[model samples]
Every structure is written in structure tokens, then in C-alpha cells.
Target: MNQHLRRLAFACTLFYTAAFASASQEKAKAPDAPAATRSRTLVIEPFMRVTNSSPTVVELQIALRKFTAPGGKGPAVWLSAVSHIGETNYYGALQKHLDAQALVLFEGVQARASTNAPAPEAARGAPTKEPAATQPAAPAKAAAPPDKSAKQTSIQHTLAESLGLVFQLEAIDYKRATFRNSDLSIQELQKIMEGDPDDPADASPAKKNEQLDRLVKVMDGSSFVGKMFAGVIQIIGTSPRLQGLTRLALIETLGQIRGDITQMNGLPPDMQTLMKVLIVERNRAVMKDLKSELEKAEPAKSISIFYGAGHMEDFERRLRRELKLEPGETLWLPAFSVDLQKAGLSKFETEMIRGMVKKQMEVILP
Candidate 1:
């Protein structure tokens, strides 16, 4: 299989477990430094001023964890133990980090229902004068267009909704904006998969699976190898010994996205290039827009760049090296947790399961 496809498959498997469980910041002050040195402070740093009044700007990086509380709402973790931040505290701090007057930027396109009305006339507020009764009846309003925003959804939006939390940046009172609007929509990505000449999109679903099967067999030198690995995980997960364990302890259960995700460095060069297009380039656009906003924002106002966790490392590098912003003190929010102790499993059983899970993770993660 193509390395990208293999990685894709691993991700898909995790999603399946998610459905089963689906119902289931710090700061420091610094003394004034030289102009060039001051330029190196983080956006949140007091010394980092977009204007003389000194508006604080910061970025909040997030990963998806359950939005509901830990009682059977969906997949979750023990707040403090795993990722070190709890769900409630995570959202609470996020709200606190976002100041009232700051502009909030999100990673999505601004969408609204399509309409035929003239832009100027609608934006002008009440018409200056009522049109004469004789004026030709405005062409019967084309069946009022459907609400476009209603239909449009992004991963970020969906995840937030699932958690029953909303970003202040997304609030009507806030000046919400998107750093880049030219991202590939879901339909566009689907088209790419369908249009690839080697693997035409028009194939029947069964045929596509057959093709994928053949590809995997060739790539791994045995069609059964992938199934065997999955079977091992399934056995480890469902064994009676593990019955008392929480869903989080299941070897293949989803929502275990913890630890450093730096393994992208091990991917083939071509795969790396693909990821750069998917992630890094989008961030460059974000930084470009951010620079413009910083220059224009009112002094003493704050700004928040809320984006995925994966983007932060690269963004911080760009901030310090390119934008002359230095890293400030760190804050950790509990995003996901799996309370093995709560599952009532014995220490010996937990260790055995952890060993199996770790072995499987090692095999697939890199």
C-alpha cells in the first residue's frame, strides 16, 4: 500500500472505536530590552506590543477530547493524571485567555447562505427612501436561498459542538475572522480521491475495497498480516481478564492521542511534502494574516489564534525565528484521559494490557 494510504488506514480504524464510546495558560513579565530583543518576545509577552498601548496576543492549540463530563457522555480521561489538564479547566482557561476586545481567528471559511440580493443595498441598512410603488416589483425574490452557513461545517466546529462548548472567538460579540479562506473543502478532497487516474473515483465501493486489499497484500507481502495484527489487538481488548477495564484501556480504542507526535519526521520525503501542503502551508497563510492584524489592531486589545495542537510547534518556530517572538511560560490543559484505575482492573491485568497496547502502538505509530 502507499505509505500515505497505510497511515490513512490506521487513522480510520481509530474512528470506529470513537463511535462506540461516543455517547462516548501561564504568563511572565520581562524587563524592557533592546528593540530587536523586545521583538523576540511571545505575542502574549508584555514587552511584545503591536501598538504603544500593548495589546496581548496569544494562540491556543487544542486537541479533541470529550466535551461532556466523564459520566458516560463519551470517551474521556481522568483530568490530572494522563495529559495533566482536565476538560473543565481546559475550557475555562481558554475563555480566560481570550480577552473581551480581542479579535478571534479560527481555521475555517466564513460561510453564510447564498443570496441574490445586491451587496451594497443590503449592507447600506434601511433604504434611504422607500422605492416608488410603481418601481418594477423587485424580481420575485428567487426562493429565498437556503442558509449556507447552516450546511457548512468544519472539523473544528463539529468537535466543539460535540463538546457543548463554544469559543469566544466564535461568539457574535467578538470580531471573528479566518486567517485563510482558500482551503480545500470536504467535497474537493473527495474529488481528489475519486479523480486519481490510477485509482479512478467512479469505482463501486466493493471494487474499491478489492483494489485496496490487493494493494495492501502487495505492500505487506501477505494479505493476512494486517488482519492478524488487528486480531491480536481485538483479543487483547476483549479478553475476560480485561472486562473490568474502561473502554479507554482497550488497545484499539480511540481517544488515546497523547505524547509527542513528532513521528512525522520518520515519514518518507514525499509523504512529508504532502503533509507540508496539508498543514505547514496553511499555517504560513495564518501567520501572514496575523501580521497584518497585529499591525492594525487597537492598542491594548487582545487577539487569539485558536488552532489545532499539531500546528503549534511550527507556529511557535515561525513566531520566534521569523516573527521575532519568543516562547513564554507554558500551560497544559487536560484534553483526553483514560482512567484505568476507575475501570477496576487489577495491577497485573493493567500491566499486561498496557504491554500489548504499547507493542501494537509501536508497530503502527511510526
Candidate 2:
């Protein structure tokens, strides 16, 4: 192995030791870092920034556990796309790090038309300019163009409404701005999907998946949806409105999509990165905004987010810098801990999950 790999391995080891010890303090109390020495930090990843480089998946998982070290009072940890993207990359490693508990999953795309949209022209006291009573006789009214936003809202609402039936969180990709819009429809979306393409067997998985994904969208591209979601994520990242419930809603939305996400309409490969921006990066943006929100919302004892694994790098870095992340600070609490307990492992098994997570950190982030 090269020197770089060796160093990484060593770093992973130290972090894993620290994290595992902290989460399972029953073994031995991890040394407490001085309180004032730290400012609360958020952990994010460079999944967006780093490309063409294959960071060890195992190593990254190790790092995740360390950063998300549960039972630590330092910084909080949030992870997403952890199990959704490339095989064995993030979510693939999840088999080992069962300690990671995701609170929400993304649903679908929805956004306000613009980030800086002014209040409705009417609301601003702007006088309405009525059309002139010109010479032409009135023709029969045509059918109304579909309301794109409303279409998306119905889908999102339906999905959210259905989520509690199965998962603990509401998984989704929809944005609030999109929900605010009144124009959208299931028929319009189906028409959009109908024109996309047919999949050939030889096509790559990504391509096939993109095609399949679009089949599910029922609508064509909505730039309004895209930009709106980006804006809301930006708003959530920096705004003071972030409360645990809101964050929970977001996490649950994303998580619910994990299983339901079908590759009917595959997006461009670049969109893989974009989705990360939508899901994970937005989480960072929301948390960055959360600093201000924390004063009011009373941030959770902890929160776990699961989205595209690709966004892990970008979001984790953002969390560290913005949230003042400390190692082993954020613990990935498992929502299904009891489920794991019943899976044949005793309390000792739970400790094993903690150790497994620690091992991944030890393996990856050195």
C-alpha cells in the first residue's frame, strides 16, 4: 500500500477508537475534550466538490461514524444519500454501520418559481392593467394550462401522507416553493414522461435508471421546481425556521424515497450530483441557517439524515466548518434499534453495531 493509504488507515483507527469509546461509554469513557475549546460544528461532505477520486468507501464510512459519534455532547451529525447511490459507496457500507439512524427521506421536486420573487403584483399595491376593450369579439375560452406546482404538491402531499404507514421519517425531494405554486397536474406530468425514451437492455444502469426515473415523474422538466427547491434548501440552510420537526420532515421525506425510487426516468449523470445538491447540500445549507434558528428551535438532542451517498463529502465538510464539528460529536442514532435487537442480537449486539461503525471510521478516514 502507498504511504497515503497507510496514513489514512492510521487516522481512521484513531477516530474509530475515539468514536466507539464515546458511543459505548460502558466500555470506557472517551476522553472529554474541553467544552470551550469547541464551537458546535456541523459535519458535511465534498461529494459535490471531489470527483474522479475514489476515496475508500470503507474509510468514509469510518469517518461518518466518528463524526456522528452518538452519546457525545459535542457536535451533532447528519448523513444522507448514505444508502441511495453507488453500490458499496456510502449506503453499501451501511450494513456495518447500523447505528446510523435516518430521521427523514426526500420525496420529490417542488419549488417556488423564483428565489427573489417579489410579492404578487396585486399584493404590492400595483394597479392591475386590464386588457383594452378592443374591437375583436370574444372567442370561446380554451382549456386552462395545467398548474405544475399544484401537481407536484399533490404528489408530495400524497407521499408524505402515506409515509407514516411504513417509515419513521418522511422521505422526499419536493420543495416548499413548488408547493406554494398553484399550477401543476398529474396528466401534464404523464404527458411529459411519455415523450422521454425507451430503454434498451445494453444501456448502462445509470442510463436505465434515469429513464425509469423520468417515467415516474409524470411531468417534463420544471425549471421552476428546480430553482425553487434550491432556494428553499438555501433558505432552510441559513434561515432561523429550522426546528427538529421541520428537519424531521425533511429527513423522513428523503428516507421514504430510498425504497420507492425507481429508475423509470433516469436523469443525466450530472444530475446525480445535482440531486446531491438538492438533498444533501441543502441539508448543509439548512444547518448553516440553523445556527440562527438554533436559538429558537431548541435543536434536537441529535438528528440523523439519509440521502444520496454522493453528497456526503460536500455536506460533511460544510457541517465541520459551519457547525464547528468535532470528531465523535454527532451520533447516528438508529431509529430501528429495537428492530436490530430483535434481529437476534442482544444488548451486546447493539454494542457490536457501535463497534462496527467505529471500525468503518477506523478503516476509512485515517
Query: How many collisions between residues are there in candidate 2?
Result: 103
Best by lDDT: 1
Residue-level lDDT of model 2, residues 74-185, one tens digit each, is 3354453332112222333443332333222221222212222223221111111212452136422211222344443332222222222111112222222111112112
Give the Cα error of residue 152 in candidate 2, in Å. 14
Candidate 1 contains a number of clashing pairs equal to: 13
lDDT of each: 0.33, 0.30
Ten-residue segment with the worst summed lDDT in candidate 2?
21-30
Q: Residue 344 in candidate 2 has what lDDT?
A: 29
Which regions in candidate 2 have their CA more than 4 angstroms from the true location?
1-71, 85-284, 329-366
The residue-by-residue lDDT of candidate 1 on 136-241, one tens digit each, is: 4552221122123432232222333332333222432222221112122222323333443433334543454444344323222244644443333343233332
